[model samples]
Target: MSWTGRFLSFARDERVILVSIGLATFGLVSTMITALTMIRDDNEIPPAEPKTQYITQDTEDSLQLDTLEKLLDHPNFSIKEIAVKILCDRAANDPEVITYIWFGITRPDYEERMDSLRTLAVLTSQTGNEGLARLHDEKAYSALVRCMELCMQSTELPVVTDIHWDEYYLRDMGERFCLMFLTELINKYGATMLVKAKFVEKWLAKQAWGNTPEERRRNFKDYMDYRNNRITDIVNRIKHSRRGLRALEKAGLIDKESSRRRIRELPDLLMEVEEEIAAGEQSGEQQSRRTREHSAEEQRLRRQHREAMVLNDGTRPLGREDIIERDASPA
Candidate 1:
């Protein structure tokens, strides 16, 4: 017989069953080999470390006092906060920590600068001789003045978002903290410090609050309030002093003519603030009236639509729940 004839005979014979079993056996062995190869490859690969473990290891192994000080300028606010807190705690025992905190005020990172200010506040708030000494530190005073000057010169507003809202809020808090700290310093050490920094007149001037009208309007009330409070504090100090203007003049703390000018102009400045506040109130009322009118108009239109729907359907008006149910029903 020919080979084709023999193959045809094989397809018709029981031996075909043996051939099928052999093919099945070959496939199973090939599959096992592939799976074993994959298993070996997986075993050779290294496992990845958890992110938290990596961070913990890095901090514990590599972070030193100087490293933490440098971390104050880190982009992450949480990192910066941690660094500042660590540095502040160290400042109590090591005065060298204060030097790092002072330099942090001059950093380009606003969060770092603000955190440094907060640390200084805590350091200065310590009771007894230590606190007194920190408050009197000329270097601390100079750093504080430099921080205020830098803040005043910074006209750019950071973009506000949910992620950045804390930074924005801290910036405002920092400004207020700076002012309050300055007030405390003046009260304790006198205005000579400000005079020496040549910031006395700048503080007296109307500060640039914002770049736009909307921003200015938003900040107007708070800025004016704080400014008024600061000026009032200074005026009160000058007035309550034992020898008054003459004593201030003799001590060369503040210019004699300048003090007289500020006193004379105080009433006019206060009257201007009151008038502006009244105008803002009136504007707000107008806006509220417009909003109420708009709401009423929307309610009226909704009622008309409901009435039309009832007339067209020849039935009771469809309520919100009824409409929702009708729409949700399977077609």
Candidate 2:
């Protein structure tokens, strides 16, 4: 008989077949019951945990963090808002990312710098002591001072004004909260909180004017002077000048070793110095002309003596003692 017919016959007519079928059914039912029991027991199987990924350069899934680092360079307003969201959500804990964000605040694009500063203030407020303590260094305060200045707070308060928070009304609470916190800090401690440490204090002194538009424009000019070989490299040549070097050393914003390395990388350090010298020369020339105008009589006598000497055919006095006396006479 075929295998199928034989199996059917065995199952239908044999006691052995019936016994085997009953056992097979029992085993299958028992296995299902065991599985259910195990599932119901909390400790029977180890629990599975949801996976979490931290922010990093390689993180492709986090669009906000990725875009925030590049927000200062982007022209789109919506993209910047999305970037702010991502930064507030994920990159707050990452120092490098935070530093990159600070760069945007320090050297921003369009309103991106302003937007980034608002986000930073919000994060600072939310993180409280934990975040503040971590950022107690000079660089953090310097950046904060600049941000506050940009917001028009003379005291460099952490609290942001309506001008900063409500201007665009991007509808993001995170941005508003940041502005509020910053404004509050400024309102509470004024600019002192911004210049807490001695190093930061020194940086504040040097960059005191840096927050102002005019001062920043001047700084840009100074930077250009340095770049065009007008003045000394403020970072390098100033190393020996008491005010310059001391300020540089006390500037916690710069990593000393790193700054030194960067200074070494640069080709010249006295571009601004040259500019200053040139400016001085021009001023000196102007002053000299003004002096000659004020002493016209004396200048005329001196000029006459010079002309007479030149016309003397390389020898002899112009008109003897009278000419000499007139030339020597004070106006």
Q: Which prediction has the highest lDDT against the true structure?
A: 1
List model 2 lDDT by residue over 1-331, tens digit each. Answer: 8999998887787788779899999999999999898878956667699897555655534454445588846789875654555555455667886797667775635377667766666676556655554554456656655553444332232211222232223323333333454444433222223323232333323433356555544543344343422112222333322233334435443435645554333212122222343345346432211113246664564454444322233222121221222245455
Q: What is the lDDT of residue 216 in candidate 1?
A: 42
TM-score of 2: 0.25
In candidate 2, position 3 carries an lDDT of: 100
Best by TM-score: 1
Off by over 4 Å in 1: 1-90, 126-129, 155-171, 206-228, 235-331
TM-score for each predicted model, relative to the true structure: 0.36, 0.25
| Per-residue lDDT value at 63 in model 1 | 66
Deviation of model 1 at 175, angstroms: 1.7
In angstroms, how far off is 183's CA in candidate 2? Answer: 6.5
Q: Whole-model Cα lDDT per candidate?
A: 0.53, 0.45
For residue 79, model 1's alpha carbon misses the true position, in angstroms, by 24
